[model samples]
Target: MDSVTVEGRAAAELLARKTSLAQTATDALYADMPELTTRYGAVGRERCLEDIRYTIDHLIPAIDLTQPSMFTAYVGWLDDLLRARNVSTREVIRSLELIEQAVRNELAPDEANVVASFLRAGLDSLGAVRREG
Candidate 1:
């Protein structure tokens, strides 16, 4: 995998923490995005897990989160996929919110800032699509 670009630390330290926090985000999604859970049904956990991983592996990096060139591409692709899946854009936003909440509750203060930054950026990217449309 390409190195994570979250500012202020070794890529290894930041990237390695992703999995530790994944389950908390996952749990929050189950509680907070019930409609999404229902929409995906039997695959809800898998789908939610996938989202958490995508946020960490793709969205968390400074390259993906900070640069509009790459970030906009992710925004477009995710919007298309959600539309095809019949998932509301708001549901995704709520899930990102919950992920941030979970990170704040579970991580050290600085680490929480780092982790929540990715979720916030994702929520912002998704909202941008709505404004453009």
Candidate 2:
């Protein structure tokens, strides 16, 4: 099979494992930011998982279709939503960075690279917005 087909398959495989991946990533996130549990309790923990799951859900499509804009747009929208809820930009940046790290750690090199590219795109989008404000 061609490279594109192989990459698409990999992306599909990642999507199929989204829940576990999100859970693993959320575990890493909480380990890194324990205050989330102390500050927000069970509700906060669940929100973190849901947010990471939402990101993964959008991310797989972006990777499969080879469209960074798809993921970046979602990041932008998420940033807006979080900002409206009074979540700081630094927290958002840290969360995405940690998710990228956690997800990358779980994949093979090739798949990890694909995931990194999309995560970087999302981070870059957030960075540009941050620079503006």
Candidate 3:
């Protein structure tokens, strides 16, 4: 396969894995606190899903199209998006835990690190961007 194809596939896999993680996290959160779905309202749930979808769409493509910096930028965008929504810290932690669990289940250690680093860097970059913007 061509370099672009290879990169795209890798990025796709990364995104799929991330989506799985997010879904797992969301499921667990909903299961634990059934009220959250109601408290947040349908619009809120839709917004949250939209944010996740946006991350998978825009952020993953950036990773495939550019280098690590671009990937970081995407993550930064996600961080800003999440923060703007005022997602709770507990929710963030749950998401991270779900990511960790999914990574452990589906990826090798090194691969998992790559995914985690991308997420962490993106979050950090987003924080900086939010502060400046």
The global Cα lDDT (0 to 1) of model 1 is 0.63
lDDT by residue for model 1 (40-97), tens = 7758687767766676565445533354345446656776887787777776676668
lDDT per prediction?
A: 0.63, 0.81, 0.58
When 2 and 3 are scored with TM-score, the better candidate is: 2
Taking the tens digit of each residue's C-alpha lDDT, what string does model 2 give over 1-133?
Answer: 1245645865776777788888888888778778878877898889988998998888887888888999999999999998898766767777778767766777777877878888889899999998898
lDDT of 3 by residue, 1-133 (tens): 1234545554666676666655665666567667768778777666655555555555466546645677665555455566677765345444544555565567656555655655566556655655686
Q: Poorest 10 consecutive residues of model 3 by lDDT?
A: 1-10
What's the CA RMSD for each of the models?
3.7, 2.1, 4.5
Global CA lDDT computed for model 3: 0.58
Q: Is candidate 1 or candidate 3 better by TM-score?
A: 1
Which candidate ranks first by TM-score, i.e. highest? Answer: 2
Best by lDDT: 2
State the TM-score for model 1: 0.72
How well does each candidate superpose onto the true structure, as a TM-score? 0.72, 0.89, 0.57
